[model samples]
Structure formats: structure tokens, C-alpha cells
Target: MNVRSARGAAARLAGRKGEIWAAIWLMARGYRILGFRLKTPQAEIDLLAKRGPILAVVEVKRRASLGAALEAVGHDQRQRLRRAGVTLAARRPSLAGASVRLDLMALAPGKLPRHIPDAWKGE
Candidate 1:
């Protein structure tokens, strides 16, 4: 429709593509994708993955550059994602005994998806 709306739609499409790419990359590295685009009342997690006894809540960001993507998820966002990961673990019986952590996947044009595991500090 409008230019702004069209740009927003395109951005969303690009973000979804980035997420799918990140998931595939993770799978190749032995991580099994459990979920994506999970939204709750408190927060939203872009992707959930498992590798052995580790369950990761991944935040996917696609931007003009890798640095831009990495900076997209700030301190507040990390805290929210951490909280969501905890909530996800608590609500899922299957994730019991698994260590839950926060991860980040940064994607940019002509670049590979960068997966940063346990990028946030938690108590």
C-alpha cells in the first residue's frame, strides 16, 4: 500500500528469511530447532533451539551490517529475552533438566549468520 507500510513489510520478510537462515545454520552445527516467533504476554522469543542438555532462546536480527545487527538487541532487550527464556523453560515440561540460555543470531547482506551463545549475563 503506502511506501512506509511496504518498507515495513519488506523488513519483516527479510527478518523472517534471516531467522530461517539462522535456524538452518544452527541445525548444521548440531542444534535442533524447537520453535520460532514465540510470543507471550511478557515477551517474545525469535527462536528456540536445543543441543544436548542446553536449550537456547535465540534472538535473530538482520540489518545493514553485522555490527548493526549485533547492536540491535540492547541491554533491555537482553533482559526481556532472558526473562522469556526462563518463562519458556518453566512452562515446558520437556525442557526440564535442560539449561536454558540466551543466544543471538546476527545476519547481514552478503554475510553469514553469526551465532553468539550465552551472550547475556544472568544470575
Candidate 2:
């Protein structure tokens, strides 16, 4: 494999690890994982979770810093995730009546995962 492909693979692996950690962290905090790497036409949701009546649409990022991880999701990405969440809820009967929330799970080395709820709301 070329250098670019190898780097891409490594990044993907790290992202998968981050998603797993994020899911575990959420579960520990009373959230139940519904899906992982859920691909819709509009976007890919890193993790889907639920706690009570809230359906959390999570975007997981592993960056050098928690702030960088939070900033990694930009305007366009947020829009896509919003659309994707709507589409997912419309198609999934089980998600009916649950409030959809966009969440960001930031993972950095030597630190616990940071979860930001309603991350892009009113932004």
C-alpha cells in the first residue's frame, strides 16, 4: 500500500477505536447503544444511542486535543448529521416519539471521553 493509503487505514482504525470507547463511555453513563457507523445517504453517524426518550446522534472524533475534536465537526458536517437524523427517525419505527439530539464525543489521549449534547443547536 502507498503512504496515503496506509495513513488512511491508520486513521480509520483510530476512529473505530474512538467510537468503541465513546459507546462504552455512554453506556456507562446510562445510555444504550443503538447502532454504530450508521450510514445514511446524507451522512454517517458514528454512534446512535438512547437514554430515556432521547435518541442521541453521536459524532466521534479522536484528536490531539478535546477542543480540536469538537471543532472537527464543522458547519457542513452538522447540517448533514441533522438531515441524516431526520431521515433515520422517519424510517425507524422504534425511534418514534423520541427526541433527536446531535451529540459530539471527543476522545483525546490521557483523558476521558468528553460528550457534548445538543452540540450544534442554535449555532
Candidate 3:
């Protein structure tokens, strides 16, 4: 394969591995993982989890720094996440009454995953 294709494949593989690591971290922290790569018409949520009565829609960024990771989630991305959360709640009635939160899971280079719950207010 070409160099570009090989690099793309490698990146995708690394991303998948990062997601697994993030999920494991969350599970160990007493969060129950509900789904990964959940897609809606608006956008894709990297992970969906439950910690007690709260429903967390997580965005995972595997980046070189926490700032870069957080920067990756911009205004449009936040809107998409809000829409996706609405869609998710509609599809799963059980989650309708649960408190919804937008979360960020940043996997910085050579560091543990950072879980930022309610990362954004969507204001």
C-alpha cells in the first residue's frame, strides 16, 4: 500500500487502541460502558457511559497535549454532541429521565487518561 494509506491505517488502529484503554479506565472507575462510536445524524459520540443516574456522552481525544485534546472539541462539535444526546435519549427511553452530561476523555502522550465530566455547558 501507499505511505499515506499505511499511515491512515496505523492512525486508525492507534485510535481504536486508545478508545479501548479509555473504556477500561472508565470501567475501573465504576462507570458502566454502554456503547462506543455511537453515531447519529448530527455527529458521533466516542463513548456512552453511566455513572449511577447520570448519562455521559464522551468525546475521546488522543493527542500530544491536554490543550490540543480539549481544543479538538470545538463549538460545532459541542452542538453535534448535544443533538446526538437528544437522539440517544429519544431512542432509549430509559435514559430519558437521566441527567445528561458532555464529557471529554483526553489521552495525552505518556500520561493516564483524563476524564473531564461535564466538560462543556453548551451555552
Candidate 4:
């Protein structure tokens, strides 16, 4: 395989692994997972979860460091996530009326996953 394709595959595998870990962490903390790798016309949501009245739209990142993982989600990505969240909520009756929040789950090797709720404010 070409170097680029191999790298892409590795990255995707790592991302999916990170999402799984994040989901497990959330579930242990009483969050019910609603969706994983949900794709909207606006963008892709890595994870969607709920706890009480809040609907969490999660972005999972696995990087060399926690700070790098958090920084991986940039301005344009955040905007896309917001749009995707709105689209998903509108289409899913179960998600209706839940207070939507953007969350970041950062996973770095040898460190516990960090869950940052309400990670970003509206743009």
C-alpha cells in the first residue's frame, strides 16, 4: 500500500479506538450513548450521548498529548460540529428538547481519557 493510504488507515483506526474508549468512559459515568460516528450533511459527530436533560455532542481525539488532542479541534471544526448537532437533533425525535452541548474527549497514551463538557461556546 502507498504511504499516504497506510497513514490514513492508521489514523482512522486510532480515531475509532479513541471513540470507543471515550464512549466506555462516558457510559461508566452514567451517560447513555445515542450514536457513534454519526454523519450529517454538515459534518460527522464522533459520538452522541445523553445524561439527564443534556444531549452531548462529542468529538474524540487521540494525539501525542492532551493539549494537542484538545487543540486538534479548531474553530472551523467546532462550527461544523455545532451545525451537525443541530441537524441530528432536528431529525431524531429522541434528541428533541434536550439541551445540546459540545464536548471534547481527549485521549493520550498512558493517560486517562479527559472529558471536557461544554468544551466550547457558540461562535
Candidate 5:
């Protein structure tokens, strides 16, 4: 493989590792993982979790710093998450009454994952 392809592969592998680490962290914290890489026409939610009556749509952003990671999830991403959550609720009527929330999971190298619950309000 060329240099560019090798770098891309490495990056992709790193991201997958980060996602796995994040999922493990969440599981240890008692959050039951419902889905991963949930994709719709509008957007993709990295993880879907359930803790009691709360349904959390999680966006995982892994970077060297929290600022850089959090910045990755911009306005467009938030809107897509909202739409995806709505679609999830529509498809699963059981989740209709559950409290839906947008959560940001920021993972920085050598740092504990930051779980920002209710990171955004559907506005």
C-alpha cells in the first residue's frame, strides 16, 4: 500500500479502537448499549444507550483534546442526531415515552471519557 493509504488505514483503525474503548467505558458505567453506527439518510449516531427510562443518542468524538473533539459535532451534526432520534422513536414505539437526549462522548487520548448528557436541546 502507498503512504496515503497506509495513513488512512491507520486512522480508521485508531477510530475503531477509540469507539470500542468508549463503548467499554460506557458499559462499565452501567449504560446498556443499544446500537452502534446507526445510520439514517440524515445522519449517523455513533452509539445508542439506555439507562432506565432515558434513551441516549450518543455522538462519539475522539481527538487529542476536548475542544477539538467537541468541535467536530457541529450544528449540522446536532440536527442530524435529532432527526435520527425521531426516526428511532417512530420505529420503536416503546421508546416514544422515554426521555430522549442528545449526548456527547468526548474521548481524548489518555483521558477518561467525558459524557455530556443532554448536550443539546432540540430547538
Candidate 6:
């Protein structure tokens, strides 16, 4: 494989690992993980979780630094996630009553996962 492709593959694996870590972190914090890598026409949600009446569409980013991870989810991505969240709730009858939210989880080496609840309220 070319160096670029190899880097891309490694990045994908790291992201997948981060998603798993994010799910477990949320579960540890009392959130029930509904799904991961939930894909839709609008966007791809890294993790979908629930706690009480809240249904969270989570985006997970893995970077060497927290700042880099946090910066990864920009305005456009947030909007996409919002649409995905709405679509998820609309399509899932079980999640209809829950209020959907866009959440962010930033993962960095040797640091705890940083979760931002209701990270964006985009339409």
C-alpha cells in the first residue's frame, strides 16, 4: 500500500478505537449506548447514546492533542450531525419521545475522553 493509504487506514482504525472508547466511557457515566457508526444520507453518527429523555448523536474524534480533536468537528460537521440526529429519531419509533442532541467526544492519548453534551444545536 502507498504511504497515504496506509496513513488513512491507520487513521480509520484509530477512529474506530476511539468510538469504542467513547461508548464505554459514556456507559461508565450511566449513558446507555444505542448504536455506533450509525450512517444516514445526511451524516454519520459516531455514537448514539441515551440517558433519561435525551438521545445523543455523538461524534468521536481521536487526535494526539485534545485541541486537535476538539477542532476536528467544525460548523459543517455539526450541522450534518444535527440532521442525522433528527433523522435517527424520526426513523426510530423507540427514540421518538426522546429529545435528540448533538454530542462531541474528543479523545487524546493518555488523557480522559472529553465529552461535550449538546455541543451544537444546528438545524
Q: Mark the regions of model 4 whose C-alpha exceeds 4 Å error after superposition.
A: none
Q: What is the lDDT of residue 106 in candidate 5?
A: 89
Name the candidate, 3 or 5, with the larger TM-score value.
3
Q: Taking the tens digit of each residue's C-alpha lDDT, what string does model 4 give over 12-92?
A: 998888899999999999999999999888889999999998989999988888789778999899989888888888888
State residue 12's C-alpha deviation in candidate 6, in Å.
0.9
Query: For each candidate, C-alpha RMSD in Å?
Result: 1.5, 1.1, 1.1, 1.3, 1.6, 1.7
Model 1: per-residue lDDT, tens digit, 86-118? 888888999888888888888777877788888
Give the 10-residue window scoring lowest on summed lDDT in candidate 4.
Answer: 114-123
Best-first order by TM-score: 2, 3, 4, 1, 6, 5
For all candidates in order, the CA lDDT equals 0.86, 0.91, 0.88, 0.90, 0.83, 0.87
lDDT of 6 by residue, 55-77 (tens): 99888987787678767888888
lDDT digits (tens) for residues 1-123 of candidate 3: 999999999998988888899899999999999999987889988899988888889898998988898888998889889788877877897787778788889998789899999887655
Write the candidate numbers in order of decreasing lDDT. Answer: 2, 4, 3, 6, 1, 5
Residue 38, model 5, lDDT:
88
- Which candidate leads the pack in lDDT? 2
TM-score of each: 0.92, 0.94, 0.94, 0.92, 0.89, 0.91
Q: After the best TM-score superposition of candidate 4, give how far the Cα of residue 6 lies from its true spot, in angstroms.
A: 1.5
Q: What value does the lDDT take at residue 14 in candidate 2? A: 91
Q: Which residue pairs of candidate 5 clash?
A: none
Report how far off residue 88 is in candidate 3 (Å).
0.5
